[model samples]
Target: MGRPILGLRSTLKSLTRRDIKSYMSRRYSAESVFITATGNVNHTKLVRALSDSIGKIKRSGKAQVIKAPVATRSVKLVKRDLEQVHLCMGVPVPSMTDRKRFELYLINTMLGSGMSSKLFQEVREKRGLAYSVYSYLNLCKDAGSLVVYAGTSKESFGEVLTVVLNEFEKLATELTIEQLNHTKDQLKGGIVLALETTDARMMKIAKDEIYFGKSMPIKSLIKEIDRVKLEDVRKSIENYLSPDNITLAAIGGGMKKRDLPSVLK
Candidate 1:
């Protein structure tokens, strides 16, 4: 459900205790549970503590299942009187377990994840078309997306879009081995740096458990990343970043629906 808005009452009034109990009974089953902890901790004590509390929750025979939402290849434009135009373009990718997962991560880092990335240098530093530009991969259990976002003045929106699209198109054909290695090193450094923190390690452990059913050792993950080749990156780009698969979303004033096709093309 969407967040309830203040001063605007929802169609449904306050929920009764029975409604909440029924919903929890269906959703919070043992099959849907996971517990993760980091730092100085006793597993047995933690389990016991949890058992004393959440263990009382009755398990439903099975947890509720929901279908994954389909990815759409459409453009949506939201007009508003704003100083800058915001644009997001995305294309679907495989799930986290796919062999191309690491390659996709490398692709994002090379494309825009940091100050040294292509989008950052070209779109912001050189052209000054946008103040913020980045690309990221969102991976889920059954689906994923590679999304690029940029915010620019309304006058520069079209130019920024063209530059973003050109960058994506280049990935399919012009990615270089040197660039690939550089990005891989960058990603490896990032992984090592992230693991150095307790909170980051905790999140990594939780995500690995939720997605892969086990925690992967940092060395093992690094090995997989190191094994990624230039060919692998190009193949992933060709398979996933095709213009035909793209979806665009824009918000700002002075945007015409007709402009989307040309920009995306």
Candidate 2:
């Protein structure tokens, strides 16, 4: 299991006032902060106001930066009393800085990012094996993962798993020009729509600053998406979607932990 983001209650209770103050001083330093304001905001006035308020903050010692744990391939199953079986399979991929990151994003969109994506169409619309199925990309500073999730009845678990795995395996060889273009268009559209909101734009700028140490223009990202070719997508699939590197987690009432491996196979 992963460590809770807010820490355990016992751990939180052990923290002293000095510890909290020290942690806040280290983590929320001026160097680590990025502020973005949208709309008709005056840059000069905003900076003056920010400087007046932020200048009072004292810098403590540098925060200790811990590396993310390396991901390994494994399957874990947790049985519960539930009506639907939920499963998630993940594969580690390159970090956000990698040039291949865009290709992975496109692959995720084509695979299961939307209603018209491969997983949704095949697993829910066509086969009726699952009510919900989608793929997502989790890109961090130093590591990333492409994950697929589905929920289905206990009886349909095997079929759903088989379909999901087959779809991933087939991505290594079977991408069409039409699929590539369509997914690109979809991604571009989503980006444009997302940036229409001031909050989204602020979030984008903050993330870009944190990750790239600079703001990346939306046009540049769109151009990169457009530049991804069919072969690039295929290569990303072959490299990141290897069967040997896959990890599976499942939660279901009727399913037994011992039956997971055979179902996955």
lDDT of each: 0.85, 0.86
Clashing residue pairs in all predictions, respectively, total: 0, 0
Distance (Å) between predicted and true CA of 248, model 2? 1.2
List model 1 lDDT by residue over 1-265, tens digit each. 1125552454347766898789888888777787788999999999999999988777788776666678767888899999889999899998898878999999999888989888999999999999999999888888889999999987887788788888888877888888888888889999998889788888999999989999999999889999998888898888788888888888999987555547464
What CA root-mean-square deviation does each model show from the true structure?
Answer: 2.9, 2.0
Candidate 2 residues lying further than 4 Å off, grouped into runs, are 261-265
User: Compared with the true structure, what per-residue lDDT tens digits does model 2 show for residues 65-123?
Assistant: 88877888888778898999999999999888888899998999889998888899999
- Candidate 1 — worst ten consecutive residues by lDDT sum? 1-10
lDDT of 2 at 191: 90
